[model samples]
Each structure stands twice: as C-alpha cells, then as structure tokens.
Target: MTVLSYADSALSLLPPVVAILLAIFTRRVLLSLGLGILIGALLLNQWSVLDTGVYLGQRVLSLVWDDGAFNAWNLYILGFLVLLGMITALITVSGSARAFANWARQHIRNRRDAKLLTMFLGCAVFIDDYFNSLVVGSIARPLTDRYYISRSKLAYLLDSTAAPVCVISPVSSWGAYIIALIGGILTAHGFTETGHLSAFVQMIPMNFYALFALALLLCVAYMELDIGAMRKHELNARKGNLYDETKGLPPGANADLPEAETGQVHGLFLPIGVLVVATFYFMVSSGADALAAESLPFTIIGAFEKTDVGSSLFFGASIGLVVTLLLAFIQKIEAKMILKALTSGARSMLPAIYILMFAWTIAGIIGSLETGKFMASLASGNIPFALLPAVLFILAGLTAFSTGTSWGTFGIMLPIAADMAMGSHSSMMLPMLAAVLSGAVFGDHCSPISDTTILSSTGAGCHHIDHVLTQLPYAVLVAVISLGGYIVLGFTESVWLGLASSCVLFLLGLVWLKWQQPKNTNA
Candidate 1:
C-alpha cells in the first residue's frame, strides 16, 4: 500500500477540478483525464515542464503494466467485463435477446410499462452495481427501444437504480463493505460496542439521497417527466431516433452481427438465471469460507462481510460464460460462429475497460496528492453541532466528486465524521454517518468518471457523455434536496421529519419542472 502524505494545500485539489471542468467543457473524457494526470505529474515534479512530460509518460506506462493492468481487482473487473460482453454478444447473435424483447413486448403495453419494468429489474439486481447495470441494461434495452425510449433515459434509469439501491440494501455487497468500514472506524475510535450493523440500520432512514433518487426515478418514469437535455432526447426518441445523431453510435455497435435464424427466449433467460444463481452461491460460499472460525449461527450478513466480491463476481461471470456457450452449441450454433460472437462481445467492452483504467489511474494520482485530506482539513474549527451534518454532507460530496470514487471518499470521510460525532454530537452519530454515505453516492452519481456511470452508458448502449449530461440535472436535484434534509435533521434530529420534508421538497420540485415543460417545449 502506498502511504499518502496529508498536505493541507489548495494545490492538492487541482487535478480533479481540472479534469472535471475539461470533461464538461470539451466533452472529451479521455483527453480530460490525461490532462489531469499530466497536471498532477507536473505538480509532483515541482513544475519542471521537461520532467513533467517524462514523469507522465513513465507513470502511464507503469500504470498500464504494473498498477492498472496487473492489479488483481483490475484483472477481476476486466475478466468480468470481457465475459459479460461475450455473453451479451452470444445472446444477441442467437437472437435470444430479441426473442426476450419480443416476449416482453407482448406483456408490456407501452412506454410506461417498459420503463416500469426496467426500473423493477434494475432494483431487483441490487447485489452489485456492476452486475445490476450490465444485466438490467442488456435485458431491458430492447424493450425500451421497442417503446421509443431514449438511450439516455434508459441509461439514467440503470445508473440511478444501481448504486442507490445497493447502498440502501442490507444484504448487498455495498452494505457489507460499508459495515466493515464502520466497524473498523468504531474499533479504532474505542467505540467497539456500537454495533456497526445496528448503526447502519439506523442510518438508513437518513439516506436521503438514495431515497430521493429512487423516488425521482419513479416520478420520471411514471409521470414522463423530462427536463433539460433529457427532454430533447425523449422528443427525439418519439421521432424514431433513439440517440442524438451528432453523438454517434455507442462503442461496440452490434450492427454487423447477424441474428440467428431462430430466436428463443429460453436462450436468454436460462443464461441470465444461471448467472444470478451462481453469483449468490459464490458470494455465500466465499463469504462462509472467510468466516469459518466464527461462532455458531453463521449469519448471511456475517458471510457477506467476509465476501471477496471481485473474485466471486469473476467466478460467477466465468461460469455464466461457459453455460452460455454450451447453450449456444446445444442450439446448434456452429463453433466458428460461437467464437466470432464471443470475440465480438468481448471486443465491445474494450472502450469501457479503457475508461475504467484511466479513471483508476487518475484516482490513484489524486490520492497520492492527498486530495481527500486537503478536503477534510477544511472541516476544522468550531462549528455548531446542529450544522455539522450538512457541512459533512457537502464536504463528502465534494471529495467523492473530485476523486470519482465513492468508496475512496467513504474511507476518507467516515472516520472523520465518526470522530466529530463522538467528540461533539454523540446523539447524532447515525445521521452524520448517513450523511457521509448519502453524499458519497450523490457525488459518485454525478461524476463522469465514476465506474457505475461508465457501466450505465455501456450497458444502455448510449454515448457516455450523453448519459452524463442527461443524468446530471436529476442527480443535482436529489442532492440539493438531500442537503436540505440533512440540515433539517441537524437542527431537529428527527429522521421522520427530515425524510418527510425531503420527499415534499422533491414533489414540489417535480411540479415546478412539469410547469416549466410547456415553456421549454415552446422555446
């Protein structure tokens, strides 16, 4: 592990700020990230322009070889992506995806039902964001397309549900990771008896952003609430175009692949079913192995705490791929054709893989510069305890947004938030903890470089920047409401009051947007 020095200087904040601004302005994510990395290198090398170039070159090479490529986590994610891509390709080639879409279309009457089903599926696959995004998008894309839903809207639904649902679900990979983090922080701070799980449960109601995001999803889907760039995309979809023409087809367009002579819904359902079952099996078994020495009554949550999520996902995906290939052969797909489909599917995922690698590299560079610590330092000084929750919420969001990694932000903020609550406002610990988690998700949702954001676009087959642009307005609205909720909670310390107030605010905001829709349409 690389030990980062905590520097309380404004320079530490430059990389991510530069990266975000450039991405928004230029709409070139790769170039923006590269420039951010270059700036970080220059700062680290004491502003020597010549050395900065050499340092950036060497760092990029090392990252590709040593860090990004060779890291076990990265390799696991790559394997999962490749296998998932292959599975998706095989399904499409076998016409299984089309078959499933046709079957679904028979049951789904119109756009509203299609959107509802998509949301339901997204919410159902809450084990991991990666799995949720890929699976939901793959299965629902055809249905949404058949109903004239924009790819941007589909991407928004996928992206919104994945992280938000996982963060709130108790028996998920996210919950396990968060509980472990909480446990460690409590232990370190001499609060071992606090019951991390209990605290987590208590914090759920105060997870305003997750709640609001999910609520807004339903409002957007059922109410057909379209605003900003999303409205334009929706209007275009209604006109028979699924995406912005200027933005072009998403990477890994399957236009060239020939559909099978016969499409079978079972071909799609069976493989996905096997994948889901296998994932849970692997999660439980791996988790159990890690908790073998524990006392009697081994709980599911306990197993989850010890689960190696990356390995389990890779294991399940590999199994799912094998099963899919066998099914293809059983359906009399030629060996040569199967190979082609698999290769094509895996090839399609390369763009997303590239984005993930660069995102990881930039995250690492920003971490080395101690950007989190610099942000944390800003929380110093005597402030009213009633205002701390809102303050921490904003600070956590800023950190996660800049780094484009919620897990990283959690590590930086959780400990500090815990310490603050313990020292000053002991009674408000759960709310503060919830604020941190909520803020982290809020920031991650809005960040273009976030892994979930990238996967959402990939899964929905939408241009990445378009997904980012269309989703930003919704994310910002929820975040604004969440901040207000935290402030209310900070003062009243009433979870019910805070939650109710946020919900009301969200509804009012929706009404305002709906009222403005006519003006937007006219203009």
Candidate 2:
C-alpha cells in the first residue's frame, strides 16, 4: 500500500492522538496501539479494506524480516528481554533478592533512605536505558517495598532516571548514538570549530530538561514531594497497598512463584554483576570488531558507535542466565524447581513482549505516514532567531510524543534543528540541539507507547498506565521549567543564565509543592 496524498496533512495526526487518548482513558495499551495501526493503514490505503489488511500484515512481517533478511536487531532485543526475565526469576527463586533486602534493612532505616538508594542505583546504571530500567527495579523493589513505597513510585523512579540519565552521560549507548548523529549533522553543516565529542560536552549544561528531571527525581526522593497522582500512589503504598490489586498483575510479577529459604545476597549480586560486566565487554568488543573491519581507528567512542547494542545485550543476558542457573544448582535447588522458575519467568515476559511488538508496529506505521516530517515542516517558515530553541523544543516534544520513539524524532528533527540554527542563529546551534534532546526525552517519558516507559513499568511490577499517569505531571512540570530555560537562553545567549533560571524555577516548584501538600507520615 502506498501513502495517500493526505498522509502529509493534518489527517496523519489522528491515529496517534486517538491511540494516546484511548490509552489514557481506557488503560488498554495494546488495544489503543492496534487501533492506531489500523487507522494509519487505512489512511495509507485510502480506506480500502483489502489493501489495508495487506499493508498491515506486511508491516508486521517487516518487524521480524525485511529486504530478504531477518531483522536480527529486533529478534536479539526480544531474546534479551526473555533471557532477562529468566534471570530475574532465577535470582528471586534463589532467595538472593530476599537476602539482599534483609541486609539492606539494617542500613536503610527509613522510607527516605530506601527511595534515595533506589534513585542512586538508577543513576549508577546509566549505560543503557533498557538495562537501567529493568535491572534497577528488580534490585531496588524489595528494599522499596520494605519501606512501603508504591510500585508506582518505584516505576516513577525508574522511568524518570533511565532515559534522562542516559541522554546526558557521554559514556552511554544513547550518548554514542546521539554523538554519531551529531557528527554527521556537524559535517553536513560545515561546522569546523568543534568536534562531535566537544560539541556534546558543550551542550550538556544546556540540556535543561534532562538535568532538571534528575534533579526533580532527587527532590522527590529526599523531600518526599510526590505530586498529583504520585501522591495518591505513595499514600496507598504507605497504607501497605503497593498497587491496586484489582487492576491485575504487571508484566514482571509472577505471583505464583515460590522462593527458596536458604539463599544469600551473593546470589543476587553475582548474576547482576556478570550481566553488567559481560554487556560492557561485549559492547566494546563488538564495536572494536566493527571499527577494525572498516579500517577505522580504534577509539572508545568509535567502538561504541559501531557496537551492536541488541546483540551485545542478548549475549550478556545469556551469560548471566547461565551463571544464574549454575548458582541455583550449587544451592541445591531441585531440578524441577529450577525448571519451573525458568518457565514462569519466560511466561511473565509475554505481556511486555506483546506490548512492545504493538508499539514497534505502530511506530513503523507512523513513520510511513511521514508524521514526523509533517511536524518538522511546521518550523521551516521565517521565524525570529531568538525563539528558535524554544520552537525546536516544542516541535521535538510533539514529534516524539506522537511517534513514541525518541530516536526516530532525533533522526528527523536534529538535522532540521541544526540547519535552522546554523543558517541564522549559528551561535545558538548547541542550545537548539540541546533543546531537541531535552524535549525528546520529556516526550519519551510521557508517551504511553514508549518502550522505555513500558520497560520501566515492567521493571517496577506496576500497572503500565499507572506509571504513565503518575509520571505525567512530574514530567510536564520539568518540561515547563525547561521551556522557560530555553526561552531565556534564546534571548540571553548565555547557557549559565538559562541554567540558573531553570534551577530557580525547579526549586520554587519544590517549595510550592512542599507547602501545598501535607507531608507523608513516613517522611
């Protein structure tokens, strides 16, 4: 099926809007995405039933295979998710999670301590958002639960930290991908004064939303400033109801699994340690291999740029899974019990896998509709130079929120944003680019179909929509604060002044929330 002429028009916006609104109101994520895909297909096919069906089937098939080859990246990622599920289950069955919780109980005396520790763990695991989202929640849940922190709150912590932290850290997979993109953009723009790495470093302070998001997370943790729906969830958690039982179990929560009585903290630590180390090793090795094949210099950043993230993650999870199984055997867990845990863990991941599949499908459909290009086109007209950063921020946020993929938005908007800035506001290039990064992360944080958001909910064992709803207000507040910062930077052309403005607004937000809401008893 071919895209209709109307594909580039306002009609293209209908599908995602329908999906997002439905998801928010009905809380049926898969259904919403499916309907959106169908609408997108119908639009592309001019409402022909047969063509729509054919196009939809072809799009779904393209997810796993296209161009006479298997989509190894997608398959590898799906495999990694299953393997990680098994690893999580194996560790829980080994009683390591419990042992670690028991050990933590001695050191963490209050709810604030548990929350702060969780945030710290999230920040520490900044290599990849996917790994960060899943690993942090699995490790931090038991401790947070001990302090009566809601699964929703746990999810908020994971979702907020994962992407925000990764986008800012220069050593992360996200950083590598972004740097590679920026390198090309810089070359295309004939920018000669700075290298890719240097440009990225320069933009760090200008990425107001990401920095403020992390800062907001810190305040929420230490000061107990749970705003809006989050406050409700925290209250429910304090009352010993971590989540609404009537809403059904989340993706990673297998309620029927039994735990071993004799397990140690080493059981939990070893598998996670191997997983992290192996992933890092494979990433570097894979990147190096790719670089050597291309006869490129073997720099760390170059290697990361060439790394196969999906394959590396899959291999790392496999190694970690093997170690987990061996640990179980050494602990003398029966073969039948081990087998049960394996099946249960894999089974627990099915819901998340299903959601991810639908998300990927609809994202592809949206791409075909050229929704992002259409959105980017809006900013092409003559506009004042001083407002460029703020405009790019809003446009980037809209594109990502519609498409549910920050990387896709980056690909579409970065070039346009860079070109716009370089053409007139050359000095504002870094600020505009930073605005795009900040806005994309904010949109990714808010989108119901975003993979990071889904993984965060899965990791924390909270209902996905609950995580979406609870995190929305917090994300919006930061976006608002960042928008103001971009505006200030656009006018003043001073990164520090812009950053100072955001910091002030953020602190003022915290103080206002503190004064307006009653403090939690635990706080």
Candidate 3:
C-alpha cells in the first residue's frame, strides 16, 4: 500500500487553520472551505500560479465527479438525503406533520414536554446523524413553536442528540465507519485477534462527551435550564418571538408547503414508523448478506460490522419515500400535487447537499496534505505516557475543530492513537480510543462549518450562527468535563472512577449554572 506524503512542516497546518479563522471572521462557510481547498492545492503544487489554478480546478472536479457524486458511499448518502427530503415534503404537503403537531398540542401541554419530545425523537432516530437532525427537526419544530420554545433551543436539542447519540449507538452509520477504521489499523498492527466490534464496545463506556452531552440535554430539557445566549433566546420565545430580530430566521422557515386540512395524527405516525422500521430492516439484511459472503456466522454485531451503512440507508430511505407517497395517495392527495411536493422537497435539500459536498472536498484536500499526520506526529515524543490520553484528546479536538469534521478526524487520529497505545500501556488503549472519538465529536459539535451543525440549524429553522453561539457554552462545558475524565483515567486507569467523577462534575456544573441564573437574568 502506498501512503501519500507531505513535507511534514508547519505549513501543513495552514489550510485548515486559515479555513477555520476565515469562517469565524466572515461567517461564510462555503467561501472559507473553498479558500482552504485552494490554499491546499497551491501548497501541494508549490505555488505556481498557473499550475495551482489548474490543480484546483481538477481537484474540485474530481472530488465532485469521481469521489463524491459517483462514488458508491457518496451516492448512497445523496440518495438517502434526496429520498428523505421527498418523504418530508410528502408529509408536509399531506399535512401529516402539521396534523401530528396539532395532536401533540393536546398531549405536550408544557415547554418541558415539547423539549423532551424533541430530544426523544432525536435519540430515537440514531441510525444516521443526518437523518436524525432532519426528521426530528421537521416533526418537532411545529410542536416546539407552539410552546414558544426558541428556534435556537430547538436547534441545540437537535444538534446535541445527533452526532452524540450516533457515536454511541452500535447500530449507527458512525459505528460502521469507526469499525472499519479500527479494523484496518488493528490488522496492520497485528492485533486482529481483538475484533473491531469488541474494541468499539469497550470504548463506549469511556465515551464521556457523548454520554455527558446526552445527560446534559435531558437535564436541560426537564429543568428548562437556560444560560448564556440561550437564556435570552428563551426569554424572547416566551414573548412570542422565536428568533432575534437582528439575526433573522433561516430561509428554510419559508418553505412552501400546503397546510394541514384533516389534522389527523396517523398521517405523521405511520410514515415515520415505516421509515424507522424499514431502515433497521435494510441494515440487518445488508449486514447479513455481507457476513454470509464472507462465510461467517451471522450475529447482530458481526452483521453490523459487515454492513454497508450508506447503501442500507439509501435503500431504507427509498422504501420510506415510497411508503409515504402511498399514504399521501390514501389521504386523497392528488398525483399532480404529490409530484410538486416531491420536486419542492428535493429542491429544499439543495443548500444542505452543497454544504455536504464542500465539506467533503475540503476534507479530501486536507487529507492529501497529510494535515492529521502532521498533528499526530507531535504526540509521538515528549508527551509523557501518563498525560498522553489528555494531550491526545486536546490535539484531536483542535484538529477536528479546524477541519470541521469528526469522521475525517477519526480517519487521521484513530490509527495514530491505536499505534501509540499498542506500544505503551495496553490498558490505556480503551481510554485513548475513547478520547479520540470524544474529542472529535466535541470539536465537530462546536464548529460553525460542520455539516451536522449546518443540518441541525436548517432542520430547526434557526440562523446558523445563532445555533453555533447558543450551543457553544454547553458543548464547552461537556468538553471540559470530558477532558478532566480523560486526565484522571490517564493517571488512575479506572474507567468506572473516571466516569463517576465526570458525572459528578457535570452535575455540579449544572447546579452552579442554575445558581448563577439570577445574576445572568439581571445582567
């Protein structure tokens, strides 16, 4: 196998660093990412203006055509997204979603229930983060709006539950990706005896950030706790203002869909139920086939290990779209109206699809520059064994923050972290692995340019920057708690102790925030 090489100089960091800074300063994600790709191409081509321009164009074209639009994994994601959009459109056009919201109005009764329902839906759709964000947002938005919950709060709830839940769920797209990365690394390092699925299971307990985020989300929902910018948004929401007048609402808030005439809940439940059931069925069937192809016995975990997640998701989404259309027809929705809804729905996804493509392109550019390698190389020496996990966590977090991608961070850091652990304290392997995963998620959760973050904002009909600002404090709080846990685990090597301490710390933090709420309100 041939590995792409770079000069291993500090310049290797320029592309991502510049991209992150530009995004923060300008708040223009597409421009920032495009600039980052251009810079990487120029660096790779040694700054020849003509060659750099040519290389940049070729790279973009190749990424869109060869690696993204046509690639099997990319195609699956595109198909899934399009089909999901169609399903959402059908639901909206048929008035199923609005009807469900009407039904929920009678049952929800309070702000806490609305928020909790959003969180529950987010957690329930754990198969894919993209699916989770969009589906939960569409279903929960109307209910949240009825309760006067801030769009920022809705976005935060959707965002928090998305990647965090997927990272921990063993049957998710995230799990499949992590398994493949770990499996390849273990095989390369002659540690194949410890199966990838088993190793991933071991890391779950140590995934402090994901666990803490979920716990904190539930606490926030149940307590109706509002702090920082989120507090202001919540206060405004109570006055019938869903968003800040200055920031304005997302364009998605103005989608052109028909109103609910029937106000029946079955329109919502039956289609979503089909989507959930069909997704799992396809995942299991695809995984089973893969396992059989390898002449291996079919077990649930083993099947997931072999599953093609993107393809399964695509198939599942397709089935969901079909089922939703059938339901729409039964509801007396005309064929012409259904066609219009499908077109409108797919069209609505264009912004998110473009963002996803740019994110992928930037990641590819950074990968070619070997940026992760340069960052990981710093961990090889000078860092003490006892502090390695904590240090690695910080490094991984910074790298993911700069790149705005958790999966890309995993691709870069997992192999390096695994190798380092194999050569040192074998017992530290789980903590280190968990550190990388947690750190990546923490960064991705916070980054304004992250795809999931964008999707979350879009789903909740919140301003993208508003979502980032309102959610940052909570993400940082969890990250701090997770970092402390990793440091303790590094020293004590006790997963239970580390987890216990982290939970206590998180609870204390919440209490302190609550105590300071009066001052915050006064301010």
Instruction: Give a tens-digit lDDT track for model 2, residues 1-523.
Output: 5657444598888888999999999999999988998998899899999999888888889989989999998899889889988988888888888888899899898889998999999999988899899988888988888888999999999988899999988788899899999989888888867899999888899999899999989988888887788888888888898988888778887677778999999999899899999999999999999999999999888887889889999999999999999999999998888998899998888889999999999888888888998989989988788888899999999989999999999999999998888788687888898999988999999999899999999999899899999999999989999998988998999999889999889888887878867754447
Residue 68 miss distance in model 3 (angstroms): 12
List runs of model 2 lying over 4 Å from the truth: 5-7
Superposed model 3: Cα runs more than 4 Å off: 1-7, 67-69, 180-198, 241-256, 334-336, 519-523
Ranking by lDDT: 2, 1, 3
| Tens digits of lDDT, candidate 1, 80-178 | 888888988998888898888888878988898899999999999998898899878888888898888999999999999999999988788899889
Summarize candidate 3's per-residue lDDT along 179-207 as a digit string, tens digits. 77777877887776788888889889899
What's the distance in Å from true for residue 324, model 3? 2.2
Error of 1 at 171 (Å): 1.2
Instruction: State candidate 3's TM-score.
Output: 0.90
lDDT of each: 0.85, 0.89, 0.81
- lDDT score for residue 401 of model 3: 80
Question: lDDT score of model 3?
Answer: 0.81
Q: Which candidate's TM-score is highest?
A: 2
For candidate 2, what is the TM-score?
0.98
